[model samples]
Target: MDAVRPLPDFLVKRYQGWKATTYADNRGWYKRLAEEGQRPRAMVISCCDSRVHVTSIFGADQGEFFIHRNIANLVPPYEPDGDHHGTSAAIEYAVTSLRVGHLIVLGHSGCGGVEGCYQMCEGRAPHLEEKTSFVGRWMDILRPGYERLAAGNEADRMRALEKASVMVSLENLLTFPFVTKAVEDGLLTLHGLWTHIGEGGLETYDPAAGGFVAV
Candidate 1:
């Protein structure tokens, strides 16, 4: 294997600074966490976009949330076909093992993964249509959402698709037997959230209103 290089100077400096301040300030809390293990109240499935800061958005402290990030913040339909499933495994662990009270799917504006899914569905992105493309296959989960989207202008359509991604994930979460059991047993609740990246606006899906409303 190739020899590993040292961390970037800026990152190393930032880590040292944090260690001197944040870690030092919370040393006892950190030690307790290490000994007790995590017991987060919620599991958040969020996009892997760097701009979508899940912990910062909620002002979550260390071990407050069990977060899983992936392309488009998606959850695929449960398939116990013996294939590797990273997202499914995380959900199972969060629900069945950690017994988190809430499962949240957090989608955000200007999501490149959602845009790619929209483009692929519209036949405007031939590259993403290739079977060999991992993103294309992964985003196939959102095709139903794309098909359900109403006709609109480009910008509006993209924004709608982003929210649809979150809704689709929420629906897919129910397909997991463990998730279904947890919900039915009143041990877990599911939530769908979307944020406007530029304005820092948050919205939650309201089934009664049949749309997202500002939170």
Candidate 2:
């Protein structure tokens, strides 16, 4: 393959600097992680939004978490019909192979994917409704959430759907036989989280409360 263009200088420079500084300071830890392999205690499924910083907020070191990110941070119902599923594959490996004790589905305020789904379900984004729209197809998993949360004004509904998206993923995760078995055997637990970007706040889902409360 030929170069489309030279890589951005700033990104390259930043990586080089971080490699020399942070990695240098943690060389021994990095070497130990590489030799022993990653044994993360938890697996986090979050959105692809650049603003969402899972590691910085958790203050986690390298190899502490098995993280998977996709738009809207969704997980679809399990289907073994010989189809390609990236999120499912990651979850399978994390639960069955890695044996992670906790599985966290992290949603965020002002999620573009959630907003898109809201627009899409309301017949606003025809382009997203098209079959070829990868994001639209992926967000179909969140349609159930929007349907259940169609109350209130647009802004409130969108926010409700954002949290609903996390709930939906947490539910779908249990649809996997392996995941169910792990949870039933007390080998795994499920959690849902929603973050407020500008407010720098996080909230945990309490199944009993049936609503989000600050954390």
Q: Residue 96 CA error for candidate 1 (Å)?
A: 0.3
Instruction: Give the lDDT of residue 7 in candidate 1.
Output: 92
- Write down the TM-score of every candidate: 0.98, 0.97
Supply the TM-score for candidate 1.
Answer: 0.98
Candidate 1 lDDT (Cα, 0 to 1): 0.96
TM-score, candidate 2, is 0.97
> How many Å off is the CA of 102 in candidate 2?
0.5
Model 1, span 117-198: residue lDDT tens: 9999889999999999999999999999999989889899899999999999999998999999999999999999999999
List per-prediction Cα lDDT, in the order shown.
0.96, 0.95
Model 2 over residues 77-121: C-alpha lDDT tens digits? 999888999999999999999999999999999999999999999
**Least lDDT summed over 10 consecutive residues: which range in candidate 2?**
1-10
